[model samples]
Target: MNNTIKILLAEDEPSLGQIVKESLETRNFEVFHVENGEEAYKIYKEEQPAILVLDVMMPKKDGFTLAKEIREENSTIPIIFLTAKSQTKDVLEGFSHGGNDYLKKPFSMEELIVRIHSLLNRVEKIKDVEKIKIGNYTFNYKKQTLELDNISNLLTHREAELLYNLWQQKNEVLDRTFILKKLWGNDDFFNARSMDVFISKLRKKLKKDENIQIVNIRGFGYKLMC
Candidate 1:
C-alpha cells in the first residue's frame, strides 16, 4: 500500500545520471539510479518501479531490449527513453519497444519533470475512477469492489475482469474461447478452472440483481442478460 511514485533511471552518462536523479528526488520521486541497462533491468525486476526512465545507448542490455522484456511481464508500466539519437528510425524503434514517452539528449530538466508528472497524473486518474455500472451492478475494477443496487461485495481480480468483460458484451453471448484468450492469455484447462472460479464469484455478486444474470451456454460460452 506504499503508493509513492517509484522511478527506475538508467543512464550511461555519469554526470547526467546524477543530475537527473537529484532533480527527480527533489520532486519527491523515489529513484533507483543505475549506470547501465543491465543494472537497470536487475533493479526493475526487483523493484517493479512504476515509471522507467531509460537511456537507449547503454552497456550490457540496450534500452530497447530491456523495454521488450519488461513489456512481456507487464504491459501497462510506462517507459520513457532518453537518447541522443533523434533519427526517425530510432524514435520509431523506441516507441515500438513499448516506450510511453521519449526525450532527446541535452533536454532541459524542467521539460523532463513535466513529462514525468503528466504520465503519473494520467495513471492516477485511471486508478481513481469509480465503478462502471452495467445492468443493476457497479463494477469497480480498481478496488475489486462490486455492488448490486446498494449492497457492496468483494471480488477477486480475475472475477472483476470476467464481470467487466460480460458487461462489455451485454446481451451478447461471449464466446468461451475468446474470453479465455483475452483474459487468461490461453484456453487451456488450468485457465478454464480459473475462469470457473471467477464465474462463481460473479454469480454471487449479482444474486440481488435478479434481472441481471450470467447464463452458461454449455460447450459454447456464457452471456450477461438483463
Candidate 2:
C-alpha cells in the first residue's frame, strides 16, 4: 500500500518541483508533477491520485480553483496546499477550498512527508470502521448507505460524512465549530448555514427510527440521542 499511494503535485518552480517529487518518491509515494493547474486538473482526472499537493500560485488555474473543482467531484480526498502565503486569511481560504492541510513555502521536506503520512493515517482510520449501528439505523461507511428495517438509502458523500461524525459522538454533544471544521474545513457563517441544512436532511432521513433523535443545542452544538 505504501508504494501504491499516489500524490498529484502542482508546482510551477522547476527546482522545487523536482526536489519535492524526488523526496516524495524516496518516501515510497508515487508522485505526478505538473507545472500548471490545467495540467494538474487533467492528470488528476486521469489518474485520480490518492492525495493532492498544490501550489497556490500557478499558471492557468490556481490551486484554490483546482481544489474546488476536485472537491466537487470527490469530497473525501486529502489536499495539501504549498504556498508562500502565511496569513491567517490565506490559511482560511485554503481550508475553505477543501484543503486538508497547509504548508508554507521553503518548508522542510521532512515536515511535508510527516503531514502527508498523518493525513493518510487519519483516512485509513476512517476507512477501517466498515459499518456502525446508530439507534435503529445501520450505516455502512464503505457503501455510504444507511439501512433501517431492511430499507437502504444511498447517501451523498457529505451526508455520509456528517452522519458518521454524529454517530461517532452519539449521545453526546458535538460542538458546531468542531463539526464545521471537520466536515467543511471552516466554520464561517455560510458553512454554518450549510451544515444546518445537512443536519435537517439527516433528521428527516433518520425519522424512520422513532428512537433516534438529533437535538440542536442552541448556541452550542447538537446531540444524537437514542
Candidate 3:
C-alpha cells in the first residue's frame, strides 16, 4: 500500500499551480496538478488523492460543482477551495457544496499546508466510520450528517462527535464520564446538562426510524439500540 499522502491541485493559473505543486512535492506529498476541474475529477477517480486543493474558477467545471459531484460519490475526501472572491455568499456556497475549507487568493504556502494538515487530521479520525448504517438512516461521520429517505440532517460538531461515540459501542453501555472527558474535557454539571440536550435532539432525529432507539442506562450512560 502507498501510505504517502497524495494531493490533487486544480488551478487554471499555471504559475500558481506549479508553485503549489512543487511546494507540496518538496514536503514529500505526491501531487497531481491539473488546469481544469474535469481533468481534476478524472485524476481524482484514478489516483484517489488524500486531499484536494481546487481553484473556484476553472474552465471545464467550477470547483463548487465539482465538489458537489465528488461528494455524491466520496463524502470523506477533504477539499479546500482557492478563491479570489471574499464575498460571504461565495464562501458559504463553497461550504454548501461540501467544501471542507476555503483559502482566499494570495494565500501563503505555509497557510495552505496548515489547512491541509488540519482537515486531513479530522478526516483520519472519522475515516473508519464513514457511511455507517444505523437502522434506516445512514450516518456520514465525515460530513457530520445523518441521511434518511434522501434527506440529510446536518449535525453540529458536538452532536456528530457524541453520535460517533455512541455508535462506536452500539447496543452497549458507553460511560458518561468517558464521553464527558473526551468530548467536553470534563464532566461538570453544566457540560453534563448540555450533553443531555444533545441526547434529546438525537433521539428526536432518530425517532423517524421506529426500529432504532437510544436507551438510557440509568446511573451509567447510554446504549444505542439499532
Could you give candidate 1's per-residue lDDT for residues 24-141 as a string of tens digits? 8888888999988789988998998989999998899899999988876765576889999866567656755766667888899998888887666655655565668866678786
What lDDT score is found at residue 110 in candidate 2? 90
Q: Return the lDDT, model 1, position 92.
A: 52
Model 1 error, position 223 (Å):
31
Candidate 2 residue-wise lDDT, 1-226, digit = tens? 2456899999999999999999898888889999999999999999989899999999999999999898777867888999999766676677667777778888999988988887777677775566688877889875668998898887665677788888878899999999887665569886777778779989999998799999999999999998
- Arrange candidates by TM-score, highest first: which order? 3, 2, 1
Q: List per-prediction Cα lDDT, in the order shown.
A: 0.78, 0.85, 0.84
Candidate 1 wrong stretches, greater than 4 Å: 1-3, 127-226
TM-score of each model, in listed order: 0.56, 0.62, 0.64
Cα deviation in Å at residue 223, candidate 2?
8.5
What is candidate 3's lDDT per residue for 91-208, written digit by digit as tens? 6567667776677899999989988887788677665554989999999877789999999988654567788899999999999988976654468675577678779989998999
Lowest summed lDDT over 10 consecutive residues: which window, candidate 3? 182-191
Clashes of 1: 0
Per-candidate RMSD vs. true structure? 12.9, 5.9, 7.6
Q: List the residue pairs that clash in candidate 1.
A: none
Give the residue spans of candidate 3 off by over 4 A. Answer: 1-3, 127-144, 147-226
